[model samples]
Target: MNASAKRLVFLLLPVLATGCARTAVEPAMSRPDFVRGEPRVTVHRDHDDLLSAGLGLAGLAGTPVPFADPAHPTAPELRRRAIQASWKGIADLGPLGGYGQAYGAVPAVPGREYQAFAWVPGARQPHRVLLQVPDGFDQAKRCLVVTASSGSRGIYGAIALAGAWGLPRGCAVAYTDKGAGSGFFDYADDSGVALDGRRARRGEAELEFTPPPLSAGAGVAVKHLHSGDNPEADWGRHVLQAARFGLAMLDRAYPEQAPFTPQNTHIIATGLSNGGGAVLQAAGLDDAHLLAGVVALEPNVQLAGQGRPFYDYATEAAIWLPCALTDASFDATPFARAPMTRGWPQRCASLHAQGLLTAATPAAQAAQAYEHLRAAGWTDNAMQVAATTTAFDLWRAITAGYASAYLRRDAAHMPCGFRYAGMKADGQPGVADTATRAAWWSDSAGIPPGNGIGLLGGTDASTDPTLAGERCLRALWDGDGADSRALRAGIDATAARLPRTDLPLWVVHGADDGLLPTAFTSEPYVAWLRAEGRRPLYWKVPHAQHFDAFLPLPGFGERHLPLLPYGYAALDRLWAHLYEGAPWPTQSSTPKGQPRGARSLTPAMLGLGAN
Candidate 1:
């Protein structure tokens, strides 16, 4: 399979593979005829064609889906258009009808009831849901755990991951489409669809769940939600709504399958990366009273050291290049002018005197400059100043060129979040919240002035030095609404500040997560839980990056990443304790069944100060 095919598959399903073998296989029952059911979901059969292969692991074991034109619709595009057109005709059933209805079920390896539907009623485009109900489901006893996918991915990705943990244990899983921000997941291929302007070139999976999206189209563009990066939609609310909708749809579809009603069902939420954050937010939503617990895998949240002018100075410098790269319309005016650039010379001089800022080119120069600053005996402001000039070009090369496969992958996987914009509440073209503007960015470089780089020669009106003329200079450093109280209500809701019930919370984070580091999310979350006397279990994956927890490794044969499966184990323990009166295990072992190691969050982790 090529990279494009792989990316398409990524959009449709979870990126992680199952660690456990199938324990049960019920006989395939009569498949539900979705065409006759309520217009909730559109079920597609698994076939050898690229469309079916993109959604499910069917044929095309080693066969690659040949690419035609980069402009026209490929297999994934056709499917997306079909879904959108179908969504236009869906009758408004109000809140209950919005989630649509389940058509039929396909038995996957027996015992598992896999059903696909187009829930989420009022969306501009039709979002999809892939639900799996294990054989012999009892809502009164066993609980259902819905999942959220990362970035602009659909619920299929989460469904795939849930297959590893939940489905094996008679747990039902519902994965929702995140709007129009995902690609298709192809197991046979590697090269999948690329970003087509704002919309996905292939898959119209769930869009990014950002602060702007959750505002329910307050100041953001509704059309942009299905297209371009930075749709300015509040995705947190979308996730929560979709989750509630999914549960409702499931109840309507399989009322007799389980006795647990939406009100009485013990529904928990879990996700990885952005989805992880969404689940956390979902668990915190006011309507999430039924949500029992949350298992956040590398959730996107703030950290103490992540705040600017406090800690993690050197590490902040590393973010500049990626930030600039993702912002297609990035401007170099602010860094080229005074005040912001005034200290560059002195900082460069001090750094050079201390043996920093080596090469003159973009990549080399930026690396050399950051390396020296990272070493020792360097002021925080100095390194930040020196990184201004070359970081932009360096970031450009990274997005375009092929130095690290992960870098290219990260760039490709980025959602429609970052566009050069302002922070005003006005319904303008380039006005958005800090979180939406900084999370997912384009690699293009057509940054409109005053949006990305700030005003050319003006003083910042806000007291925060990072906010220059409405342009947030510290966007990448202080991403996801750092220091902003605008979305406090949403933030608090997602953070679950007011616990709905005493459901045992568990957070398993990868210490080496490149994107959403554990220091900012799980570390502080665990501390908050401890303070609240919730006694949350916080587990760490040592030397593992974010993607590493999902994808397979070359040498270790999947055994190297023992920390990944611990999340499932934790869930098992929770289920057993909640349902079967089993004692919850205080700690979980790595995938290899070994005792996991521990690490503490420190300033040095973000390159702020010495450990």
Candidate 2:
């Protein structure tokens, strides 16, 4: 059958290839309906390839690759720099961090990368989907590993985790941003990120995002914050579309190996953090019976009405965690910067004024706040580790990004008086420079107070600068306003919607994960799954927590192990169970898996002897 005719056949009769066989008999080449336009395909060879964009393990470990011209970066330059930034953002590539020696590295896999924009059925915004098919892909024994970006990062966000493992194995790697990416729309410049990762004027190119117009100087618009899509609710659908796109592209890549469908190809979905949550959501929403298995690492998930929603706890932490961190016991928790933390005293005094704390001194108030945080479901270890995330202003940034998403609000009318602007040298909000605006697509992490985009407004005068906005955000959850109700409904919709499927599911979470506390997320969610008659494996690592990027900091490596190694091991076990019929590791039966104590990570840490 011809390519166009076969694509139509599959599009019209969706299930025509449900039982597609090894021997193709009129192959059902399904062309994904969500793919918006023709893919911009590029072949990478020699100095450039799938895993690292030509920068080898050593180069990726160093400084970020810079563009030849800041104002005009080509698709290849943006792609290269983004890949490097993503690697450093997600994994610990420090010399002693065990990337090349223990778990993963930039594997030299020559391949062709296909990039395209995919739209949800009725959504105006488009999320990016990229597929990498290595030259060594085994057509007969087909495999595809798919993932969504972990946090508010660009499309390359999870490449360090997924592509590093899959590409070397000759499996195609499918990635999607899941509606959260660094597609910044600078209202001041009247420009936005184009499909090729360049800054372009409104009508110059097909922009990745074009938020509601601002009144001349209201700053930039972040896709995650201003898309008005309630994207988290549709993360599962985005991932499913990513997989569908990968499958169709795979068919197109190798016409000789035609009829490659979900029924015939072994598809495994994996991701970390928000991406982790995305994969689990995909597992739940696999009503089409597409996914063969899922492996989620430190996933941000809540069982329907069972666990604390991210919005609830994240907003809570933004208000109280820093107040709690002033306690003496939190003196040194890896990466906490003392200068930035000095404002905690004023924050405590402000909370006291608001009747949130009733103590005589700031220290005493901090103790009270810590106790309050414990009451709100934070464990001692988790709160101690929360110092790292808190110091980086993670709680506030995450809440700001998600609040807009939940309310389906635009940048022009953000909730709680929040807005984004470029920061000048004097630390004031203004129009960012031409160079900074040009690099937004590759530099920003899809959140404000970063990459020249400063978060502004909410309170003109406050001792604690970000406190007022945080309080306003908390009030949204605590209040019964129409906007709050709408946001609440959106937050509630993020809970995994699942049907009964005993597909090979593996969940690996750090027991000491302070940001998404294991007690509030994985423990309860796993129990809920088992009660639903599905047996999913769960691994709770003792000395691990979120953010491997923190490992190179003073006490971090000594106290924690990287979750990437364990996550990689889980994928190994899942593949074995699927292809070799190997039994699921016995460690996961109990939520508390093998505990390698607070020491340096050894190769044996994953229970898989040396690499």
- Give a tens-digit lDDT track for model 2, residues 1-611: 24432222111111000111011133344567787667766677766777887778887777656766776666677778778777777888776677887667677888777778999888869899989899899776699999999887789888988898889988999999998888888888788888778788888988888776667676778787788888888899999999988988888788888667888899989999999999988888888888988999999986678888988898899899888888887877654445667777788898999898999898899999999988888998898888867776778777876888888887778887888888776778888887777776765556666667777776647678788899888888989989889988989889986644668888889888988899888888888888888788888877788877767666777777788888888888888887788876544542232333444455665555531
lDDT (C-alpha, whole model) for all candidates: 0.38, 0.79
Candidate 1: C-alpha RMSD to true structure equals 15.2
lDDT of 1 by residue, 331-408 (tens): 332233323333333433333343544554444544554454345333332322233322222222211111111111
lDDT of 2 at 551: 70
The lowest-lDDT stretch of 10 consecutive residues in candidate 1 is 96-105
Q: Give the TM-score of candidate 1.
A: 0.51
Q: After superposition, how far is residue 53 of candidate 1 from its true place, in Å?
A: 6.5
Lowest summed-lDDT stretch of 10 residues in model 2?
12-21
Taking all chains together, each candidate's TM-score versus the true structure is 0.51, 0.92
